[model samples]
Target chain A: MSAFRSLSLAMLKGLLRDRTASFFTLVFPLMFLLLFGALFQNDSVSRSHVLQFGEVAVLDEMPADQRRDLSEALNVEQVRDRDEALARVSDGDADAVVWQDEDGRIELRYSAADATRAGTVQGLMQSLVQSANLAETGQPPAFELASDQVEDKSIKPIQYLAPGLLGWAIAMGASFMSAFTLVNWRKKRILRRLWLAPISPGTVIGARIGVSLGMAFLQTALFLGVATIPFYGLRLTGFWWLAIPLVACGTLAFMSVGLVIGAWAKTDEAANAALQLVIMPMAFLSGSFFPLDSSPDWVRAISNAMPLKHLNEAVQGVLTRGEGWGAALPAMGGLLLFAAVLTAVAARLFRWDDT
Target chain B: MGPLNVSNAAGRPEPGATRGPTEALDAARPAPPRGPAPPRFGHGYHRQVTKNIPAIAVEGLRKRYGEVRAVDGVTFEVAHGEFYGILGPNGAGKTTTLELVEGLREPDEGSARLLGQPSWPRDPGLLRRIGVQLQASAFFEKLTAREQIHTFAALYGVSSRRADEMLETVGLTEKAGTRDDKLSGGQAQRLSIACALVHDPELVFLDEPTTGLDPQARRNLWDLLREINAQGRTVVLTTHYLDEAEILCDRVAIMDAGRILRVGAPSELIAELGVGNLEDVFLQLTGREYRE
Candidate 1:
């Protein structure tokens, strides 16, 4: 039929026929979902049911005037002895001791023994005071008290990671592995013949880039599907479905970087070396495996610069936080810009017959 | 040995001197195009003078790879419907010059026009209309001959019927199911030609097309070339066999060290050395018997 049909058909067949590439492109994401999914499943997700804090007493030792004023916002209670309440918190008998000190200051003393309880206690205390303070001072807070972050819904690490890891898998397949395939075509003179054809060199490059991006997108979708449908019961609190296209675009942007590598490399070895150099750092620094939120500020800064980190933030924002399309648009725009620049460089510098 | 007598060309004639298979269509290619590319795979002044003018045109074409010149200072023309052969020993730069004219490589120094347009940065229509078979083709070895031809044919934006017809024309229709790795050398060679011509191109470039074939296989391919040329398509071929060149090509250009040492009709080039055979003429010019 037409060249377009033929080219598409050939591209599809080429991908299917190459088992290794196909594995990395299609199956690997699912594999990553399996490996990392199991590796980081949230013990808390299955246990999202309310947790028991054993027995503890609240210190209602605040004066009547202060207790009534702050108790509406904080979890402080009317108790007998304030010193005994402090003792409970230090002994881990209580999760946290909440009360108003003199001068109308809210105080919270909590155990950092259990990370889950510690984080929960810390957030509740801070939010309660912030809310109370906001109401008292009549000044807007730094953040909206009602963040669009899905409320009352808890997520496991897998719920958060499946999409982010899927993006990484697509990046690996589309960017690193694809370079080797192109290098093979170049070594065989197959690409040279294509270059000689009257079709716009743009078409040739475009087709290749298109095929790789398509594969990358597919990988992202497949992994998300596997993780959401089977393992985690597909629960996304934020607008995860809205984040799908953004993740796809972001993955493609990274994959195109691989196209640039493939075009510039003279041999398959050079392509491998170059591609791996790009892939490993992004994987580690993108916060794909662990939350870089707690990483050193410098390390977090480094991750923030990585496309994957932004992709994760962008993805987790949608999937975990149920972020809206409007809020996520800037991240998508950044990825699109990166893709355009890399694509231009790739087209201009690509060589067929390695000189 | 000008254009050979082809009055009795219908039957399969034995390989012999003083004969050509397409003498009947020699009158069709009347004249060559001019300037950039001579406008007429289907148009031109001597549309009827099919057997005249060069199939390719090159002027001061030069190419370099870093320090070495791969194709240097070359100019030549092939007549219409001519089985024009380029004969040179290995590393003699024959392929490089042919590639530049085919638009596979850009000439750093000069110009080449195919079918009357600047060949480099060629138009897709021009590329679709010209066939090229490199010395060695790298195919997806797992694909059958039919599948292989079908895949490349798509790149031309042409109908698959051309691939079917070419497979049949090359006598490989019976073996269309065979993978490239399974095909014998001669069969593989024919398949490459089928892939090249899948667009029904007007000009075919056969670079060392018969390099690895046995004698019988080579003879078979020669007849196929003759039939294709007889159909009024221009054939530009390069070969290591002087005898094959003498038998097949109406004219030949002897290249040495990135330049054309001489160019003329086989008879004229041979006659220039006062020799009666291609081998004698080759020895007279390069002072070497042969390589491979």
Candidate 2:
């Protein structure tokens, strides 16, 4: 046990001292979170949409009270002229433009660049105008539509992106870090020297995996605390703490992949090339950058086979979807199985010497 | 040529003698002794008092790589506290034989025992009692020499202070804080030796410990190794330098074509071959042609 601890401490110190590895393991994932968080800052349900109101000749004839109520209900911003409102709508500075035509009918002009936002603005305007018409006629409506959303709050893009990013951080940190460090040590015959010692091979491999798992947990906490907690207001639900084990299994799985590459590759360059080939596709196809719901069936099929996909799903299920341990079992099981099988293969093929 | 008895001429010091570092190093700087003597085993009446337990025993050990036989039917025994050297030209299976005895490689046939324990089965406890230094060692690039030795010492359940003592023994105390990558080749070689002996193993295997070192560094290492042997430890070394073997080894084995052509004290091997030195005997046994 003392030997294992010493080896683990030595490996951790070596990794920390390597500036390039520190950047990738500790700093790069945070950079991703900050970049993506800022990019999707406005993708929330509570964001206010701008409605530019243009000067209309017929507005003077309508009752002042009715016009005031309509304007307030629409959240309208008064513009000097139609031309200005049209320019604002075209530039996407406003969600839509509202004007009263000569015939006294309200008309709206909106950009189709973002169809969802355009439709939302149009629906809001229609409801406000209908209420105005009822008030003008001085009639009490027979039935009123009182609507409430079933979900507590709308799902934000960051909610989905945070878990995926966390998964990506773990995959990259474990796989690339393991592959590069292992191959470099093998090239230097450091592994050979360690093997010549009294320490068991299992202890050496355990120390490496333990370090990677430690990094994985650090990445999970960092991405969650720095990005998810502040920006997305992440709420942990039933069995939320299961994320810790999920991350461990996921990290071990990817680290085993790295071990296989490290054992098979003859040089550092080859290991790096193989790592990139594995990591890039896994990150993308696993929904690290975007949702895979709209992707083609074959892409989804490929994503289903990826360990990162399961990790992202399990994390997002508990964090964003508020699911329980039962919901994350499949992903957790998959990750554990992957870790076991790949670790076995890596152990079978592992060689202390370069030859 | 006539048989020569040069053991006394080598001027080996008695065990446990106190000497300054400089004086101890100077003791190994004598000129190579010449002349030949008949093969001798367990010389003089001392043979009767010394126990006969061999530190290392190998019988019909063999290892093959595809079509090449790296170690073919090799056999030898190293008695306790003997400074033994395996000398051969390039590709003479010297390293393969050492690794087989060190438990780093599995032989295709036959057996090897170290300190009465079989080399196969690879018992970690057995490895704890042995120390090995490969020809090309790789250490953590960022760890200081002291830290590297301390780390290995911890593996063997040895005290961390042993690292300091080992460094002092190898004459590397001044460079203890230098990282392995920054050390000169000779300094790194000394560091490797220090790490190998950090656990105070009963048996030590050094594969070409002085290969790339300058003359002074080589002599210094020879002194260190002799001191280690004097402390009642077995030393098994493989080297290409004939003079190094002739000076340091109590018994030298000249190997060629995966077999030992001769095994005896340096002067006795010279006498047996009717040659001027071990180098001439090696050339005569293995041929003058180059091997890649």
Candidate 2 backbone collisions, by pair:
B3-B36, B3-B37, B4-B36, B4-B37
**Best of the candidates, DockQ:** 2
Chain A alone, model 2, TM-score?
Answer: 0.73
Model 2 agreement with the true structure over A76-165: per-residue lDDT tens digits = 567777787788788887777778766778888889876656655666556556645655676645112311121222356677778888
Docking class of 2: medium
Candidate 1 chain B lDDT trough over 10 residues, lowest sum: B21-30
Residue A68 error, candidate 1, Å: 25
For A200-219, candidate 1 gives per-residue lDDT tens digits of 76676566666766776676
Compute DockQ for each candidate against the true complex. Answer: 0.38, 0.49
State the DockQ, from 0 to 1, for candidate 2: 0.49
Query: What lDDT tens digits, residue by residue, belong to model 2 across residues B149-208?
Result: 888888888888777888877767888888888888888988898889988998999999
